[model samples]
Target: MPSIHDILTKAVALHNGGQPERAAALYRDVLAVEPAEPHSLHLLGLQMRRAGCEAEGIALMARSLLLAPTLAPALFNQARALQDSGRLDEAIAHFRRKLEVDPNCGVTSIVLGNEALARGRLDEAERILRRAAALEAGGAFASRLRRALERVTTARGIARDAADPSLPPGLVVRGAFRDSSGYAHKVRQFVRHLVDAGVRVRLVDLNHGDVDNLPDGQIDPLLHTLDRPVRAKAVLSFTTPLVVEAVPNLKTINYTVFEALDIPPLWAAHSRRHDHVVVATDSSRRAWLQAGHPADRVHICPEGVEPLEPGRVAPAAILDGTGRRLADYRVRILNVSDLNSRKNLEGLLRVWLRTTRAEDDAALLLKAGKGDGASGSIRDLLARLTAETGRTLGEAAPLFLVEGKLSDTDMMSLHAAATHYWSMSHGEGWDLPMAQAGAMGLTLLAPDHSAYHAYLNGRVAHMIPSHVTPALDGYRGRDWWTPDEAAAARLLRAVIDDPDGTRLSAREHLLEHFSWRSAAHRLIGLLGGLDAL
Candidate 1:
C-alpha cells in the first residue's frame, strides 16, 4: 500500500545495495500501479541488463527516456550500455544528445572527449576535455577531465611527430645527477641523448643525497649553458616528485619513479603542483593514478638501456673482506636491491637458499644499498629471514654482500662482474640496474610483472611466475606482485643446468628496442603536444 514515491525510493535503495531482484520487483509494482511510471521503467531496464538481457534493457531504457525526456541517469546508463555493446557511434550520438539536454553534463563531455580520442581526433579531444574540466571546476569529474586532456596532449604529439620526424625545442632539465643512485644515472642518460639529438639543453644541478662518489660530476659539459631569464619551453625535473619546486609560468614535469603499488603521501601531494608527471614505467604512473592524480596528467616516458662500452667497463665488488671478485664463481647470479620492502630482496634470498647448495659452483652477489626513503641496514633483515627459514647461510652457497659507493665506470664494472642478473621485485618504475646488467650480456631473470614485462619474454629472459599478494610494510593500499619462491628456485636450477639455454642476446635486444635517443625524442614530442605551455 506504499505510495508511488515511496516505492520508487525503496527500489533505488535496493538497486544500489545489490538487491537487484527486490528492486526489480518494486519497480514492477510501481509500473503496475502507474503503467507509465518512467523511473520504474528505467530501473527495470537496468535490472534486465544485470540479468544479461542487454538488448531488452536498452530497448526499455530507450522507451523510458522517450516517456520522460530529461532522465539524465537513464540516458547515461543507456549510452554506457550501447558503448559496451560496441555501438560506439550510436553511443557517441547519445552522449552528444545528453549534453544538449543537460548543457552542463560533465560526464557526457568526458565520454565525448574519449570518443574523439578513440577516433584519433586529438585536437577535438583536448578541446572537449578542457571544456569539461572548466564546467566541472572543483567537482568530482575535474580529475578525470584533466587526465583526459593529458592523453589528448600525448596523442597529439605522437600524431604530429610521426608525420614530421623532427625534434622539438630543447627542454630545461633539472635533476640530481651528482648522486650515485639509479635516478642520477637515468637523468644522465636522458640528458646525453637529448644533447645528441640536437636539442638545446640547459642543466640545473639538484644534488638530493650522497654526492661523495669518487670521480665527481661532469654530465656532458655542453649542458652548462647560462641563459638567464630561461626562455626554455618547459622545466623537466628528474629528482623525486616530492622535492620538485614548480617554475613560475613554465610547464613543470617531475620525472620520477616508485617501486611499490602505493605512493608515499608527501610525494603524491607534491606532484599535484606540477603541470605534468613523467614516469619511467606504467607501474609508476599507476601509483600516482591510484592515489587520485589525473591519469592523463601522468605520462609514461620509459627509461632506456645504455649500450655497453667494453673498454670503459670496470669491476667493483669485493667479497667477504677478501679481494675476491664475483667473476670467481662459475655461475655468478647478481641481485641489486636496497632495504625497501617493495624490492622484495628477502624473496630473492629465499630463492637463493632453497636453490643453491654449499658445493654448487654458484654465488649470489647482492649489490645492496639504501635508497627510496629506506633507512636501516639489510643485514639484520636477511639474518632474520635466514633464521626463520630454518637454514644457516654457512650450509648454503656463498652469499656475498656488496655495499660500497662506486663511480659510474665502477657501476658498469659491477654489472660486468656478473654472469647473470636476477630480481624478485614487488614492483618497479624502471629497474635501471636490471636493464644495465642485461645490456652487459648477462643472463637475466625477473618476476613476470610490472616494468620487467616491458622488455622480457620467456624466450628473451627467464621469468619467475608471480601472483597477487598483500603489499608488505610501508607500501599500504594496493596489492603487489610476489614471485613464487619454489618456482623461482626451479627456474634458477633449470638455467644453471643449461647455461646455453640462458643465451639471449639481451644487449642487442635492449639497445635496439629501448634506445635512449628514441626515449628523448618522445619526451620532447610529449611536451610539444601541449597547447603552448
Candidate 2:
C-alpha cells in the first residue's frame, strides 16, 4: 500500500544496511508499480552486482540508463562493473559517457584516470586526472586527485627517462647520498657496488646543501648537469616522495627504515604510493606488513658494512675536550648514539656503575650526538647520573662525554681504541653503528632483538638477555625490548676478559655475510629482476 517513493527510499535504506535481499524485493515492488522507474532499476542492478550476478546487474543497469539517459549513477556503476570484469576499454568508454552526463563528477574522472593508467595510457591518465583536480579544487576529492596526478606525473617522467639517451642506462639512485646519516652511508655503499659491477649508474643528490662539502670523487657533477630527460631503467629512491616527486615509467622502489615497532600510519600511507618497498631487515619488513602493507610488495634488503683493513688497532691515545691526551685507561667501553631515552643511556649508566669498579681503571666513552627533541641536554644527563650514583663527574665517575663531529678515519680510530662496543637500545631499524663496530673487529654487547637479529648472533656477538616491554618516551602503545642489567653486566665482564676471541668471531661473521660487496650484488640482481618485469 506504500507509495513508490516510500518503497524506493526504504529499499535504499535496506540496501545500505546490508539487507540486500529485502531491498531487492522492495525494489521489485517499486518496479512493478512503475516499470520505467530509473532509480529502482539502478538500485536493483547494484544489489545484483553485490550478489555476484555481474551479467544480470549489467543488463539491469543498461535498461535503467536507456529509460533515464542521463542517469549518472547508473552510468558510473556500469563502468565500474565492466572494470571489475577486466574489460578496461569498454569500462573506460562508459566512464567517459558518465562524465559527459556529469562533467563535474570527480569520482568518474579518478576512475577513468586509473583505468587509463592500468591500460598503460599514461598521457590520457594524466590529462583526465589534471581535469579532475581542477574541477574538485579545495575539497577531499581534490586531495585524491592530487595524489593520482603525482602518480601519473611520476610515471610519465620515468617513461621519458627510459627513452632519453643522454642519461645513464642503468639504475638511478636518488637520495641525500653524501650526508652523515646512516641512510647516506647505505646509499653510497650500494652505489659503489653498482659502479664496481660495471653498471652504468647516475647519482642525484637530493640534499643540495651538502653538495659542496662532499668528498672528492663523490659527486658526479657531469651526470647531474646533463640537460636531457631524467631516465633510468629503475629508480632506487632512498628519500621520500616529497623529496623526489616522480620517476615516470620506471619500477620505483622506496627504501625506508623505521626505528620503531609500529610504522607511523603516515609513513605507511606514503609507502603504499610506491611500486615496491625495500626495508633494511626482516624485522622492518614484518613491521610494515603488520601496518597493513601487502607482503609481496615489501622486501628484506639487509644493510652491509665496509670491512676494515687487516691489523687495524685501537688508537693508543685520543684527546679529550680540553685537547689533553687521556689514553691510560685499563679497559675502555664505548657507546655511540644520538643520546635519546630509547637508547636507554640511563639504564646503561646504572648497569655500568653497579658492575665495574672505579679501581678497575675502566672508562666508559659516551660518544653522543645532540639529543633528540624530547631528550634533555648532556649536562643535565651527567647531573642526574651524578645525583643518582652520588659520584662526582670527573675523577669520581669513569664516564667521559665526547661530543663533536669525527671524520670516517677518526671514527675508525675511535673504534680501535675501545675494548668493547655496547648498546642498550630499545629498538633499531638496522643498528648501523653496531654492524660497523663488528666489522671493525670490536666485540659488541647489545640486545638480541630488532634489526640486530639480521647480523649479530651468539657466535659473533654477546647477545644481551632481554624481554619485550611496553615502549617508553613518545613510542607509547608500541613494544620494545629491555635488556636484563644483570645479564648485560655478565656479558660486559665476558667481553673485557676475552676481547681477542670475541673480536675475531665478530669480525669473521661480518665479513662473511654483511659486506658491502655482497649487498650490492644482491641489489643489482633485484633491480635486474624488476626491470625484466
Candidate with maximal TM-score: 2
Question: Which segments of candidate 2 are over 4 A away from where they belong?
Answer: 1-159, 165-168, 208-230, 240-244, 312-317, 321-326, 370-376, 394-397, 494-504
- Candidate 2 per-residue C-alpha lDDT over 358-384 given as tens digits, one digit per residue, 9 for 90 to 100: 565567777787223322466677678
**What TM-score against the true fold does each predicted structure earn?**
0.63, 0.65
How much lDDT does candidate 2 score? 0.73
Cα deviation of 433 in candidate 2 (Å)?
1.6
User: Over the full model, what C-alpha lDDT does candidate 1 score relative to the true structure?
Assistant: 0.74
Worst 10 residues of 1 by lDDT: 222-231
Number of backbone-clashing residue pairs for each candidate, in the order shown: 2, 9
